[model samples]
Target: MPVIKLTSNTTLHYQEMNRGAAETIVLIHGMMSNLSVFYFNIAPMLAQRYHVVLYDLKGHGLSSKCTWGYHLQGMAADLIQLLDALHLRQVHVAGYSYGALIALQTAVSYPERIQQLVAIEAPDPFEQQTLARIDAYSKSALLEQIAAAGKAQGKPMSKRQLERNYNLYHFLLKQTTLQQDMLAEKDFMQQPGIDRLLHNTLLLYGTDSPCASTGKQLLRKIPNAQLAWLAGDHHIPVQQPFQVGSSINSFLQPRENRIHHFQPSATSIGVETPGWNLAM
Candidate 1:
């Protein structure tokens, strides 16, 4: 596994593909999920046309665990630091579920550092159901949920995988501030500047997903955002990876072509590299 140590002294696990492609696209997975969400199917499709980057968030996957910094702002800051470490000035960003919220926060805070944005199945932070679920999370509940998810997908959970997942859950729930940090941002979408976001954005939601309403809310807020409905629910990325990948690829292709034909203008967002510092 590849690791990059952030300025905060935390190390993150990441993977890259098609490094020499015309443009770079960064993929962020949702809460309790890792970059593996993209690594298998989506990244490969995008890599055919763009440089694709994927990383595990702090305390998730192979990344170093910490007790704080699970909030959106902090998560976005971590991403910025990672970009700085990788020498990438600006790149397209795509995120799912909680990761989508982080992507929105990043665009709002550092509009210049993002070329375009894709938000998939991002629930509204203010939703009561979202808060209630976090409040109810527990080690036993997590294991059962994972097992049920596996059964639904026709992949029965193995003892080894279950044990590994249990360990991860125990550490994150008992040792870290993830739940509290997430709860603190319950009103994030209603905050100032969210509705004013100006990036060319794509909002993807599953037709049957409860989060579809949130996608609609975002479409009304973001100036240039377009919403598209997929076939499944919150797990659309896993259930329909090829379709998701193709949609994003088509949405991003025109911009990538334009970059090759013209030099970025002085007015371009993030054209002037800005110094970044740890948000802690």
Candidate 2:
């Protein structure tokens, strides 16, 4: 891992592969995650051609958490400062879930720093549907039970304590608020610059994913956009890394005078053969 100092004494942690290459791809992880999440899923596939950079978000994983707030815009600004310190002017960017949202802010704040953008399972800032979805999942019976059990045992739960806390229904619904800031919406919606940069982006989500509708909605709003639905819900890139890599590689390939099939059809999303089946 490499370290880049941000404002204050705080430093950002990141890793890079194939440094000398024609193009670079910076992979940003979502909330509650670190750079390692992308290693098994995306790095191997992208390392040969593009210089791949992966990093921890400000307060997540191995990075320092000295910031005053958990605002996404602050995170985006941190990334801009990172690129400046590294002398990297522009690069291809891809982010998953919360990371995707931050990537959107990055694109808006510094449009010249992005060559292409890919957002997977990223939702709009303040849509009713998004709010409703978050509220529904947050207050679900299963999660409520889990919280209760965790409370009954103690705050800091052990592995066995957690395993016993889970109900059958809990297994079916994935946990969405593991380490997310509930206050993120306030910071996200207050900003106006993000929408302008979304037009030149590619949106993706899994077919079986509950968040697929958000991806579709984004596609409708963005001009050079397409929605790709992968086979697995919420974990396509993790489960089917090679296939996800192939799809992105094909999409990001540069075009000459001919307008090569740039637009993705319905079939191009998540039609790949099932690879690993990891339960998230």
Candidate 3:
């Protein structure tokens, strides 16, 4: 695993592909999820046209674990630091669920560092039901959650994978301040600068997702934002990776005379179609 030690004394595990491509796209996974969420499908698809970057957020996946800085502002700062460390001055950024919030925060805080923004299934942090669920987490519930997620992907997780999931859940829930940190950001959407976000933003949400409304809210708030509905619920990325990738690719594609320009030649895009595997 490739690791980069940040100024905060934390090491983050990350993967970079198609580094020679002109534009770079950074992928941030949701809370409790890792970079693998995009590693198998979306990342490879995007890598066809742009350099792709994915990293495990602090206390998630293979990254260093810490008890603080799980809030949106801190998380966004971490992303900015990562981009600086990689010498990437500006890049497109996409994030799913909690990661989506981080991406939005990053764009708000450091607009110059982000070219375009893609937010998928980002929930409003002030939602009572969502906060209730996070406050209810426990080891047993975490295991059941992992099992259900595996089933959703049409694959039963291996014992080893279950053990890893269990450990990760236990550490984040018991040893870290993740839940409280997130709860503190409840009014993030109501903050002053959200309406002024000037980036050409793409909001992707599932038609049936509870958070779909948030996408609409964001579209209304951000002057240059647009929303696209997908087929599945909150797990749209996992259920419809190709659709997700194609939408993002089209959105990020350069424009000519206000017309979308896509690389139609498969030979140039070099699309990868590997065997599908689920990682929770």
lDDT of 1 at 123: 86
Best by TM-score: 3
Q: TM-score of predicted model 1?
A: 0.84
Predicted structure with the largest lDDT when compared to the true one:
3
- Ranked by TM-score, the better of candidates 1 and 3 is 3
Off by over 4 Å in 1: 131-155, 255-280
lDDT of predicted model 2: 0.66
RMSD (Å) of each candidate, 1 decimal: 9.1, 8.8, 7.5
Residue-wise C-alpha lDDT for candidate 3, range 1-280, written one tens digit per residue? 8888878899999999999899999999987788988999999999999999999999998999888889998999999888988999999999998899999999999999999999988889998776554434223345555678777986665779778877887788778888888888889999877999998888888777778778878978987776777777777777778888887888787776235332222111211112211120
Scored by CA lDDT, what does every candidate get?
A: 0.80, 0.66, 0.81
> Which of candidates 2 and 3 is the stronger one according to lDDT?
3
Q: Give a tens-digit lDDT track for model 2, residues 38-76.
A: 887687678878999888876565677553444566778
Indicate the residue-level lDDT of 261 in model 3. Answer: 30
Q: Which residue pairs in model 3 clash with each other?
A: none
Where does the lowest 10-residue lDDT sum fall in candidate 3? 271-280
